[model samples]
Target: MKKSIYRLIKFSILPLLFICYAIYITGKNTGDFYKRFSSPQQNSLILGSSRAASMNPEIIDQIIHSKYPNAKLYNYAFTWAHSPYGPKYLESIEKKIKPDTKDGVFIVTVEPTALMVDKNKPDDPQYYTENDKSVAKTSMVATNPNLEYLLESYDFSITNEFNKKIRPEKNPMIEVSVLDNGQVHGKVIKRFSTEKRKEVNAEKMAELKNRINELKISPTRLEYLSKTIDFLKQHGKVMVVRMPVSKVPYDIENSAVADFDKIILDITESKKVPYINYNNYPNNYQWVDEVHLEPEFMDKFSAVIAKDLVH
Candidate 1:
């Protein structure tokens, strides 16, 4: 009986060791592959959902470096990253900031839907797909600056050849490229013709409207936002920004969330932080879709915000 038990233990331990080694190798390869894609600096952080991902760190840095030469900004935003994830993410990246770092500016884009909560409803998996890469995987490597964290969080799906093949074209509606500076450039994928683009935009806009209608600002999320502000204040100045959507969708969102500005204003005012609302951007800046601007306008938008930030 003892011999049989020992044999079982030997077999189990060998398989466990092999699994551990595989995890380590998979993580090392993928982590190194993605390391070429993100920045190492962290004096400034851009935080929000996909909206905040649009801000180009290089463009913003160019505008501010003359005034604050030492400032290094990294876009830390991810898709479907709302208030629920913000506080934890901020905490996770604390070690990345240098001990002597000062004048660290944190720009956070406030998306209205992030404030809402519906406990009874489960989130759509499509809303939070890790079809290609996981922010948590890349982020763990970024903040910890080690292989262990990266290995522990690595998803096995990344190893699948089928997943790799489709990753480049994941999310046919919006194609995003995350650069070394952590700036994510997203383009609306217009397949065949202008008519197809219009059709896609209309469907997305309708879905967004439906989601907006069901949104209810949760007290818990508001509390989390408040905590996030307080936590960020420990590092440096904080700015709350409201990014612009196209006219029709913007108007619909405004009508749905009556106290949107008021809520943001109250938080900023109480926290003594600045709030920049670009919801009324001039007609000249073109939009790729209801919520995102075309790449041509990204630099202009970043310039506007960076100018304000430096001043």
Candidate 2:
């Protein structure tokens, strides 16, 4: 038994030693990825779920460069992000994250889910793990291949970029439908790109909407929405805008969104921030389905967001 125990320790030590060695050797990459990724620039910053990421940063940067000239842009967009996640991420990196050195403008798209969540999920601890853990090495991902293991092992919230590998394998959350010249048009399809997800999303969002309606929770979905607004109060100037959606998805979810509008009005009123509910705007025939932008509309939509709050 003593010999066996010693052998076990010896074997375990090798892997542990290797991990430490990997970190020590390639610490720069891990250190830099986290610092650079989290550090905010002086221009504008965009955050949210797919919508923010789905919108092209290239075009946004270009426009900011042209208009603001000195504006620095950073893509802090995270996939599968919700309210609590956004607020938490901002707070965690607030000091490191800056929005336009000269101007204090931040644009964050609001989704209906931002208000309500189960408040319990694997992604929760997952985000905590990634952000909480010290990532001081660059080749960390390389040595610790299987990012999924790193995620589950550390229970890191999928909210942080580290868990990106575990993102749904099907449809990417965001994509560019039209990229012409310097303008970009992006689209948000469902999570799973499989034919099954594609076929069922319309129905799925409908059913999901119904289930939530039965619960009759306020737009905060429990407390996420309220918490989010409260958290953003100190993060410079904030604009929480609800992007346009098609009639099908909008109508089904309008009641909840109406409640959301009230919450937005309340937050903006108290915080002196701007919140635009764009559902009142006419649909430009660019919505591919009920919840996404067609190729043509994204550019116009991106420009609208830029024009409205970017100053």
Candidate 3:
């Protein structure tokens, strides 16, 4: 019995421990969202959906250093489904920020989709899409491993997560890495041909049009956004930004919410913060799809934003 138990410990327990250690090491690369949860609490933060996730904090910091020398910005932005402007995201933001942060930079990215809900049940928080997601469910946001997030939020098996790092996918269209600074870096490995890119954009635009009726602007989301601005105000300066999208989806957004820009303008004006609308800016930027900027443009875009922040 003693010999059998010793063998079991050697074969089973030791291997399990090694596997767990492997998973913990590769956890950050397993998904785009894991590293965001695993990192320490941030002083400065960039808040929005995936559109804002690509903004390089390093570039922003370098440019803004002359003004706010100690600003250490982390991109806490997730996808629209997970991080739309709402109570849950605000709660997570509050938890992720350093308690004594003062004179830190806060960049809040906005778009119509972020503030939308089910048209039929716009008032019901239960029906809100993000309520059941990581932003809402994750109570501990500043742990190294963030086992709570891994257990509750991660969809794949630990084996799969481990395999992702050990045996990576070959020739992926986009390779995404989460930096220590909390930026989601996406490298486009396979660029679509111009014709193929146009085709994909059209498909995305069509999908947006089809789903437009299912969603409606939510007053709760808007109020929570204002509350988020108010909460961040105590810590530092807040800047509202609308990242540029391709004209196809841009027009769709305007049609979906006729007063989108006006609404954002009103909020910025009332809050006395800067609102930079890149949609009206020059159309020289490139996109991976209709919404997100290509990896090459991220640093350039961050530089533009940083320059604006200082001025």
Candidate 4:
């Protein structure tokens, strides 16, 4: 009996060792590889979902450095990063974000959808990414297998009645960080006609109209949104930025946007925090489309906001 027990233990040990080694390798190779490369001379904390993560952190960093020359800036944008994650990580973030300069700002993007609480959603790297080179960020595995229609699309405008799976992870890989040669790295998988706006807008309007009719926002989401507002208040003045979307208008009366507007209005009014609603804000000549702008426009917009609010 003693000899048999020893054999069992020995067999179990090898597999356990193999499992631990795999986890360590995955964590090391795929984890926030970007953060390791970026110089930590940053002072400001830039937070948000994929849209927030999508912006070139290095640009934001340069913007902060050029505008507020004395201070350094780190782009801490997390993909699919729900606001609730903010308060939880605020302290540790503060540790990484402490700059040589005294005063700094925390710029968090407001993706209205992130305000809704998703219960038990799986992880997804395709939704957005931290490190541009991380494996999940570059994986060929379909982001949402159910939505087979979107596999070849640069189309961020579609919403389906089925489960919407982003990347493999629903949350940001907070354990990993991206470094600051930070530029937004995405491939324009396709470009439509000059009349592309009309095609895109029409597709978006129809899809959202169908989905919005069946949705309801959760209370825990509301609570987190409120907490996020308060968290920003505690840190510095929380500048709630409504990041631009292709933002095709919803059916004016009973569309998906009414739900978003109601939530946005409630958060801003109740919290009384200053916000930049660039979602509906007009785009100038340099815009990539009516909603999102070119990379240079990011600096222009960031500088304008920094000047108007932070400065």
- Candidate closest to the true structure, highest TM-score: 3
What clash pairs does model 3 have?
Answer: none
TM-score of 2: 0.56
Q: Give lDDT: candidate 2, residue 101.
A: 48
Going through the candidates in the order shown, the clash numbers are 0, 17, 0, 21
Order of candidate numbers by lDDT, starting with the best: 3, 1, 2, 4
Give, for candidate 3, the lowest lDDT window spanning 10 residues: 23-32
Q: Candidate 3 on 1-311: residue-level lDDT in tens?
A: 99999998889987889777866765556544878887889899999999999899999999999999878889999988999988899999999999999989999999998999988774667788998898899999988777898789878776775676678788888777788898888766777899998898889878888777678998888999999999999999899999998888888888889999889898889999989899888968887777888777878899999999999
Stretches off by above 4 angstroms in model 2 are 1-43, 65-67, 79-87, 92-96, 99-104, 119-201, 214-237
How close is every model to the real structure, measured as TM-score?
0.73, 0.56, 0.94, 0.52
Instruction: Give the number of colliding residue pairs in candidate 4.
Output: 21
Model 1: ten consecutive residues of lowest lDDT: 29-38
Candidates ranked by TM-score: 3, 1, 2, 4
- The model with the greatest lDDT is 3
- Give per-residue CA lDDT, model 1, range 1-311, as digits (tens): 99999999988998778555644444333322343222355777887777667688888888888877877788776655322343344444564455466677788788777666543454432332232244433444353234444454434443433344446445576554556666766656744478877898999889888877876665655666787777778777788898877787878778888888998899889999999889755656766666777787877888888999988
Cα RMSD, model 3: 1.7
RMSD of each: 6.8, 9.2, 1.7, 12.0
